[model samples]
Target chain A: MARVEVPELPPDPTAATKVAELEVPPEIVAQTLGEYLRAWAARVRAGDSGVLPVIAGLAVITVVFQAISPHHVFLSALNLVNLLQQSAVFMVLAMAEGFVLLLGEIDLSVGYVAAVGGVIGVQLVQPATTRWPWWAAVVAALLACALIGAAQGTLITRLKLPSFVVTLAGFLIFNGVVLILLLLGPFSGYPSLLGDDTNRQVLYHLMWGTIDPLAGWIGMIVIVAGLGLALWLRDTRRRRSGLVAPPLGLTLLKIVLMAIVGLTVVAICNINRANIGTVAGVPWVIPIVLAVLGAWTVLLQRTSFGRYVYAIGGNPEAARRAGIKLASIRTWAFVICSFTAGIGGLLYASYLGGMSNNVNGGQLVLYAVAAAVIGGTSLFGGRGKVMHGALGGLVIGGIYNGMYLLGLDVQWQFIVTGLVLLSAVTIDALSRRGATTGSVAHV
Target chain B: MSDANVARAGAQPNAAAPPAGEARLQVRALGKHFGAVQALSDVDLDLPAGQVTALCGDNGAGKTVLTKCIAGIFQADQGQILWEGKPVHIRSPRDAAHLGIETVYQDLALADNLDIVQNMFLARERLRGGLLDEDAMERDAAETLASLRVTTVRSIRQPVGSLSGGQRQSVAVAKAVMWNSKLVLLDEPTAALGVVQTKMVLDLVRRLRDRGLAVMVISHNLNDVFEVADRIAVLYLGRMVIQDAASAFDRQRVVQYMTSGGTNGSG
Candidate 1:
């Protein structure tokens, strides 16, 4: 189709002539295209590269590749669950980074702090040692991460040092601590906690020991109710506040999608993974992650502290003039980021069935950052959501798992992951620039 | 909240007591030097509330320095600022805000990313239950904008960056008004505006005065000063060369005070 220009009407032209003269001017069409090109360039300059479209494109590619693959098991139930399990840890870690990124800062220490937390978490909850209750162990791990974050934050804020430098120092120091605490060598402790070589049993048993029929129903109902309550509250608030809310049909459609996905996942997991005849429901980590996501969403959006973090991210001077205690907010943001990373660490150790010094800090940190960025959190700050990390992590995990299933090597997986991260960031930059240039719709 | 609150207006010479149609912000022999360069020295200015006080000066004529001194961006090296009848020391922007003195810098300091309501409530957001009370803020913002009759804005939810030059100025003024500012110091409010927008802004300035708030406008536009100001204080080099009512100074004399240091035809 050729481009057409909407012609300007004469002050008192006849309606017929006006209609007749409505032909596209080549110059006008060229100008419109020029404007669009300029707008795209401007958007790129402004750093909003339209990451959503890029994510959508990646999803499309994934679906197409899976469809063309000879292996039918690639899209099967067990594989999907495995993919989710792989994503769980990274998703949480990405969330931790997302919080700090929203403050226009990065916590380079998160990876190692997470590694340290994993060591301590496993040690505390290791079935043989049983030094503490599982809940207490989890709490201790989280608090340890929080305190570590607070220490780093204090150094950065009070001393007014660049977070990059401070967190880099933290990364080095924490990594060392993790290695020393874990004893560095193989065979330092008891044999694998989940009884050697069976991937999901230990974590699955620990989180949801007995996932009978009743447990599955209970979990499904809880998830549906939670999603429903969230949607209802949001709509009601929007209505009360007289803001333009999504249509009722759209809202209901979203809730229905959530319910379907939740019910389907639970049903699939109940299909007897055990060859000896018993099966289980979804893992407890699913609900735990959901709960954490909800809590953080509220904290980052509903509270003054959350808004202040965004304000500080968007414009620090403006925040200061508003009398916001910058140091306190910055400190708290890091604390929350680290605390969440601790949860991620625990989940990772549980998944691995043991803590090891061989944990790849470099690769893990990149994946976490990639997950957050791909999910649509801006690296520049003040623009992201918890859901981004969760979604982005799933996408990254999918790529890794899919590549492995297709018999690709680790090198290829790394290459694909890097490409995805770059593309996502580019799109984000483009979209933001488009919005600032006033060429994008619904900025 | 400092020692400058000692010398009030009534305690100073040539300082008329606050009465109907008379408003004043009296500054004593204020001095400020940026290292060796004396930006301002023994500068005295009286800006009465309910009257448009035009602070006119050539480039580097200490007009901006003096304005900054009064607005608390810089602590005057020597002297005090008297609002109403109290001597006050302005140490920071917060201090000036507490005294109900607002300064609209040339940059406007409005965040482009934020919408009208957000920008209007920037640095002073209304909160309920420890969260930003969006509904309450929106309502107040709407009311404030409506009272000012700023109809150019198609939607308050639109980002301020999307606004025309004049609309942005309107938002900035509304922000000041929301703070319940007593004396608003406008630093070249209409500098970049078109004719129609400039008229709209001038009208808003008049409305500010009508609402009993004192306004100090700094402008190089003689047409604007003549159109809005009740008095003009022209600064040449580092000294205030002429202080006259708007009724007393013509365009020619005002320009003379602005360019050369003296007015030959008058005064």
Candidate 2:
């Protein structure tokens, strides 16, 4: 039999044949990403969830308070710098709380855990016995806190227990541990090594150290350049994937804001703040906090673990059916919460020059939780961001500082915090109810 | 292109006659119990391809239980559900989805918070990058609705809660269609619809049949049953009393069989 000549393969069989031979009508083209985004925004505006409104209201209130303040120091450069420094520790702790809250869970042990972590770290560099370097001590402190968190996480997840009960237990146990550690002093079997004052100096130097002007400038440049590269890479990937991305103008605006904030902080710290004419720069802890926030934000927003945390928080049964290891995500969430709290604890101790037995747990846990909630994170779970912790913590810290500047008692600060937390939760609950009831337009 | 012509053309493409020998979905002596209560017992039913089979019964007739069992919401205490003649056990909603069986419960189980595209892609979402691929998902959702000729919805972006009863039913039906389900079990889809809306939903049932997907409709409304169903199965007190071709029994006999615990020769 004569072999039939095979037809040459079409360059693109599906498209070419559909156009030339199949007589199929052309498919309707989907909207461009930009066009679709504009439409989506219009829709959001018409029946928007009120997250932006809430955020805007908060900003307006803050600005108005600053404008009306008797002492114009509320908007002064020095005060702003002070505000950033004060917010640093609280931001870390609040963010740690945010991580657990996103999974519809709570961790009450962070306060004491942080205290314990700080105490342990400081004790590590005892000149009388252990001659560990500052970095080593810091690492040891973090490790201790992480272990505490992991232990609590394991108990809650493995036992299928409520986080409220488990973390409550953790709070008591860790608090006792802290007292024990502090009472025992540094864990040295023998004394007579490096002098005590040298150990004290090392601890002080590590916590409050400043870099040279050139080093500071160099560090800022590296950070900005690295951030620029990352943003550019992300934008490129999004575009290549045929996805929607923020407008270039919007991105540029964001970068400019970031630079202004960064440069202003650096410049203020670089100014001579020394009564004895000492060269001043940002506390190294500032950069450390920023780095931690950036890393944790990426972990929470970009990874599968983060997605599962949100999913479980939103609907546990849905997550279970999706084959997500709920227990593992929750455990890790608790672990991060404790770990970050530990960091905050160490920073607080460093800033205070030493950890004390008088460190309050009951009040600290409330502040941390309130900071996260006030930052616009949903207490109900499945809806929160790391940035919320930073923003919320700043707000709470600002209230404390503002009231102190205005000569208000500590009681008023507590009252303001309580009201803010209450308002945030009430707003969250109302919006959720509105969405469920199909009254989103009202929202 | 005229409405009359389209209706005439669609009227008989799917012949009123049942398939000669092929059973699309077969439930063989299915049984289920809740502690002491026998929710279902020895329930046998056959759903044929290109036909709207009505599973009709009163308030406590084990209709919901049987549908749930087939949809894998609840495991049958004893029995085999043969899908395309293969013995299978449906242990979960996901399993039922894999087996091309979709169930629209009484609540419709649609997340009111989510818009049409989101609700349609709930549990099963499209992803282009790392996040929810909104563009791709909306396009696919639009296409799916368009193929079903679901024009009741003014916009897919609108929340399901804003839709009329008929439109919501259409969405639930569309969601099932998106899963490429071979058999869709609808629980009282037209329970709350007005006359015109009910007609719209009935027409949708007919369209589903024309598309060659077996449909098992659970309804209390006999008029809806007589209007759209090709075969009707009646249950009373957790037992299947009669299952017959819709032409075999009129409304009177079907109601009698539904209420009394007696078999009718028409079945």
| Highest-TM-score candidate | 1
Fnat for each model: 0.13, 0.02
Which residue pairs does candidate 2 place in steric collision?
none
Write one digit per residue (lDDT tens) for candidate 2, span A1-443. Answer: 11122222112233322222111101111134454445445434444333454456457656866876667667665565567667777788999999888877888888888888877776777664466776788788888888888888898889877889988998899889887777654433222112346655655644466778678888987888778777767656644654434445445555777777778778887877665757577777778788888988877655556656766766565456444677888888888888898788777776667766767766678778887877777777866788888877787777766777787787887888788778777877764554423322210
- The local lDDT score (0 to 100) that residue B207 gets in candidate 2 is 76
- Could you tell me the interface RMSD of model 2? 16.4
lDDT of 1: 0.72
lDDT of 1 by residue, A1-443 (tens): 12122122112224422221222111211224355445444444444443445367557746965776567566666676677778888888999999888887888888888887877776765555544665677778889999999998888888988888898898899889887867633448422445532232444344434356578778788879887988878766865665534445556666887888788878777666665767566766777777788888888776677777776766676566655788989999989988998888877777777777777766777888889988888777767888888888888888877878878898998999999889877866765554422311121
Could you give me the TM-score of model 2 versus the true structure?
0.76
Top of the candidates by DockQ: 1
Mark the 10 consecutive residues where model 1 chain A has the least summed lDDT.
A20-29
RMSD, one per candidate, in order: 8.9, 9.9
